[model samples]
Target: DKGELKGAGFSFQVSDAQKYGQAIGHIGKLTSGSLKVGDAVQADVDQARRQRIRLNHSATHLMHAALRQVLGTHVAQKGSLVNDKALRFDFSHFEAMKPEEIRAVEDLVNAQIRRNLPIETNIMDIDAARESGAMALFGEKYDDRVRVLSMGDFSTELCGGTHASRT
Candidate 1:
């Protein structure tokens, strides 16, 4: 029951051009000196800033697992937004998660606080990732080469998000 469900397509159509265009537009806007607004950083984004943001995002995956473990068995990711200081995860569940559930989720996430698990990245042919048993997210695609991000053995996904070197 824990294995991946392969080749199941959603009923919706996604526009690849629109997705790439939106990504490019955002990058352009950030580089256009409009990102910082009134902040002290003043629209300056460097490698160090990116790495710092990645550290927080790595925590978000743990958050997803925590939610699933506490929230019954119906949770499925619906959407998300990730930025420098914070990370947001959205999932499919008929009812709202209860307050107690939220606390339980947080506590579970916090339990991994002191563990140090190294994160690893592999760039291999798409076939390699599938053959290696990586969990492919719904509605995701892979080219000839895909990037696999892993947190020890906790979670391994084909993603384009910032990440921590280790957990």
Candidate 2:
């Protein structure tokens, strides 16, 4: 991916480095952070990192709830990785959904901002969830038990994430 970014730079507005060598500067200056692509380094994640992780985790719940309301009950949280930056949600659907469907999902998600639903998370048995009609993803591997997160009746899913007090 770094190479891909570098290649794009060669064809874009910043094509010639020598042309503006005096006026502009090195290409690295245009980028963010001091960590280059191949640097042998790692960033330590402390308690501050955990708080950021929690915010991202909670936002994911909001988004998941929104998608199900807009899409369908069939929609399930396929997988997720949340951090300070943003939420990446994957769902269960055989084929790629239409643009209208994607937009509707996004719109419904934003609309939740108006409803202030509180997030409630609890650990329970997977069999109990299935008995209660709690939806699970298509190919999710699970143990005998799982965590249930309920954001009003607006969203109820089996998730393991930091929840918001809104519930």
Candidate 3:
């Protein structure tokens, strides 16, 4: 009940950010603090960690494109996790990927990475984005206005995630 700030170096650790209706909320854990109504606080992001996350997120997009090229156009992103350390991508496929197929996907992504292609982002109407050939994740909900990210001609998708300036 008391608005007491404890600990010599108390800080709020934000774990997740979500949108609820028109408002955005950050859910987190407080080390030692009693945050009541109207408690003002400052937020800061770790730039280096954020950079790593961006790199991983961009890599995920590139990998998705490579998978579709190597496998088939039927390949679609099922799920994905992008973090500072690594990226895990799940997709739809008829069968397990062969070793050579894996290598080909890796090679394609690596070649694009070597090129250091610049990443471009645009916000447009959903229909316009789709008409421009931006791939959207199946069964995923999107706003009327969407963010389309493209990396040269290698990859283009509807994404709101942070990304590196170049592959």
Cα RMSDs, all models: 13.5, 13.0, 4.4
Ranking 1 against 2 by lDDT, winner: 1
Per-model TM-score on C-alpha atoms? 0.64, 0.58, 0.85
In candidate 1, which residue pairs clash? none
lDDT of 2 by residue, 1-167 (tens): 01112332232122222225237332323343333556553322244556666767776777776677666667777688776567787777666878987898777766664577777777789989877666677777977878888777766777755666663
Cα displacement (Å) at residue 26, model 2: 37
Count of clashing pairs, candidate 2: 3
Question: Model 3, stretches more than 4 Å misplaced?
Answer: 1-10, 19-22
Q: What is the RMSD, in Å, between candidate 3 and the native fold over all Cα? A: 4.4
lDDT (C-alpha, whole model) for all candidates? 0.63, 0.62, 0.87
Better candidate by TM-score, 2 or 3: 3
- Candidate 2 stretches greater than 4 Å from native: 1-48, 94-99
Q: Relative to the unseen true structure, what is the C-alpha lDDT of residue 160 in candidate 2, on a scale of 0 to 100? A: 59
Candidate 1 root-mean-square deviation in Å:
13.5
- lDDT of model 2, residue 130: 79
